[model samples]
Target: MVRTVLVLGGTAEARRLAEALAEAGDRLRVVTSLAGRVSRPHLPPGEVRIGGFDGVEGLTAWLREERVDAVVDATHPFAARVTASAAAATSALGLPFLVLRRPGWRQAEEDDWRWVGSVAEAAELLPTVGTRALLTVGRQELEPFTRLSDVWLLARSIEQPNVPIEAVLGRGPFAVESELELLDDHDIDVLVTKDSGGDDAKLVAARRRNIPVVIVRRPPSPAVMIVSTVDQAAIWVIYGHATVS
Candidate 1:
């Protein structure tokens, strides 16, 4: 018998999990869903669907109609709504559910960092840290930083901010030296980012230059089975399906 799985995917971890499941042959049937926010996302394996499943009610009905045996939410760490919806919908149906959340970054002794509760708070806290800044909080949250217009800003985003910004287009896994050069070239006095961790280059670059950093912490997620990597999630799915079978 084949096991049907639904992966709420948009993160790097999500793509990896889908790849691992794809290697498991016909024993597992995988369908990966994307929010369609990114214009050109890194496509995952197996079956793929774009856009939301409306909301919780819509998702619950879809699960019932599709006969999905398990669900894994591998959305971006900041994607709190999708995560909550997945948790609620799966719990109601007694379906197996898991979240693949990459671990967050830690501040070290050499780092000068201020932890803010939200994006708005991070914007408000910026003036205390430095006068010129680079906002790496992604494109959506760029609006909050506009209030700090007095400070020279260099923002990075794959999509352009609606408002006029000194924006740079790039993705992560940045090299520390490359990050340092960008900062030094722009005369950036601070770096603002979310604590959604993967590579440490940009944060480390700030530390090397003695530039202050304002990090917006992640929002609380709904209680669920959370794992940190693709391997762990894959193991859980295989083990879970075996146990149920």
Candidate 2:
């Protein structure tokens, strides 16, 4: 019997896991769901569905309607609401659930680091720390920095932002050499990033230069089995299906 899997994906790991599952066999059907926020999203493997599912109740209804055998959440680490909704929906439906979360970034010896719990905290620290800054965090939270008119922000995002601050439009999966160049070009004295750690080379480069990084902590996830990689998630999916078979 064929099994269907619903993957709540927006991260690199989600795309990788969906591809792996597709290559595994014909017995399993994979559908990857993406939040329609990114302007031109890199397409993932298998079937792709874009946009939100209303909320937890909506997600639960969709899961049942689609007959999803399992769920793998690969959202951004700071995506607290969707993750919580997915967990609640899966639990209510009595469906198998797994989380594919990339590990958080760690502080290095060469780094000048100040950890903060949220974006607001990081924004508050910018005045005391540096005047010229690079806000590596996404465009959505750019509003908080508006209050800090004294600080010069070189903000990077996929598209041009309408925020009051100076913005640069670009994409990432950035190389360390390029990141270093960007740091120099922007005259960035301080960096702000979230702890969603699928990529590390850039962070490592920042650390090597002794640039202060104010890392926003990841929100706590619901109680569920967590795996660090796409391969690990694929293994869990196959194993869970085997048991059901």
Candidate 3:
């Protein structure tokens, strides 16, 4: 017997987990859903679905109609709303749900880290830290830094920012050497990023340089089974499928 699985994926782990499920063979039919935010998102292995589903209600409806057996919340760490909605939707429908969050960056002995709860808090801390700033918090919240005209910003994102604030467009998993060069080129004095853990190469580079980073906290989710790696998720899914079969 085969089971259908829906993976809410936007991170590397999602892609990996999807591929793992595909490798597990005909016992599972996997579909990975993307947010359709990135202009050119890296294609995940197997069947792909893009765009939003209104909200939790719509998602619950889809799950029931599609007869999806399990759901994996493998979105970016800062992607709070979607993850929360997934938790709620899965719970209301009594579907097994797992959250796959990559580990957060660890601070070294020489690193200077200032933990903040949100992007606004990080923006407010800019005045005291440095005159020149590098905001890597994504394009969506660029508006917060626009009000701080006194500080020169070197903002980088895949898409161009809506509001004005020195923006750079590029893709990452940037190399450490390249990121260091970017910091030096922009004369960056302070770094602002969400505690969006994972293999975000640029954030790792900043940490290595002992740069002061203001990390935005991750939003809380409803109590559910959580796994940190794709491999773990695959095993769990296989075990569940076996039990049901």
Candidate 4:
């Protein structure tokens, strides 16, 4: 028997899960749904849909209409809204669902990490750390730092911010040497970032330079069955559909 699965895709893990499901054979018709935040997202294999399903009601209607057998919420860790909505919609229909989460970074003994709740809180804490800062919180939410005239900003993202910033356009998996050079070149003293896990390039570089890092904690995701790997999610999808049917 054939099955159709909906994967809420945005993060790298989401794309990986989509690929794994696609390779599992034609028995599983995988559909990947992107949030369309990025102008050009890395398209996943199989059927792809973009944008929101409005809300929980809209999503439930869509699932029923499409005859989705199961769902995998593989959104970004920070995407609390989408995760919560997925949980609600799936629970309403009693559909099989799971969260595919990539683990966050843990602070090492040598790490000079100052944890904050949000970007605004990070901005408030920055003055205590350094006057020159590297902000890796992305271009969308640069509002908190705009008012800080004393502290110089080095904003790094895939796209540029609307507000004037000392910008560096680059992607991550950043080298320690490159990070060191960037810090040295700009005389950067503090690093600001979201707790976007599965990477440690900036954390290590900051530690080596004795740079204080102000990290914004991720918003609370809906409490649900969470798995860390694509294989784990795939197994859930396979077995879940069987159980549901």
**Candidate lDDT values, in order:** 0.88, 0.85, 0.84, 0.87
Against the true structure, candidate 2 reaches a TM-score of 0.95
The digit string of per-residue lDDT tens for model 4 on 67-166 reads 9888999987888888888999999988888888888889889888898998889988898889999999988878889989899999998777888887
Model 3 off-target regions past 4 Å? Answer: 207-210, 241-245
What TM-score does model 1 achieve against the real structure?
0.95
Best by lDDT, which number?
1
Question: With candidate 4 superimposed using the best TM-score fit, by how many Å does residue 134's alpha carbon deviate from the native?
Answer: 0.7
Q: Which lDDT tens digits does candidate 2 get at residues 1-245?
A: 77899898888888889889998798889999999888789888889999999999899999999999999898888888989999999999998888888888767677788889889999999888888888878989888888997889888888777787788777778888988898888888888888888777668777767778888888986788887877788888987633320
Question: Model 1 off-target regions past 4 Å?
Answer: 241-245
Provide the lowest-lDDT 10-residue window in model 1: 236-245
- For all predicted structures, in order, the TM-scores are 0.95, 0.95, 0.93, 0.94
Off by over 4 Å in 2: 241-245
Clashes of each: 0, 0, 0, 0
Model 4 regions more than 4 Å off = 241-245
Lowest lDDT sum, 10 consecutive residues, model 2, at 236-245
TM-score of 4: 0.94
lDDT per residue as tens, model 3, 31-118: 8999998879998888898999889999999999989999888888788889888989999999888887887777667678888888
Would you give me the overall lDDT of model 2? 0.85
Backbone clashes in model 2, listed as residue pairs: none
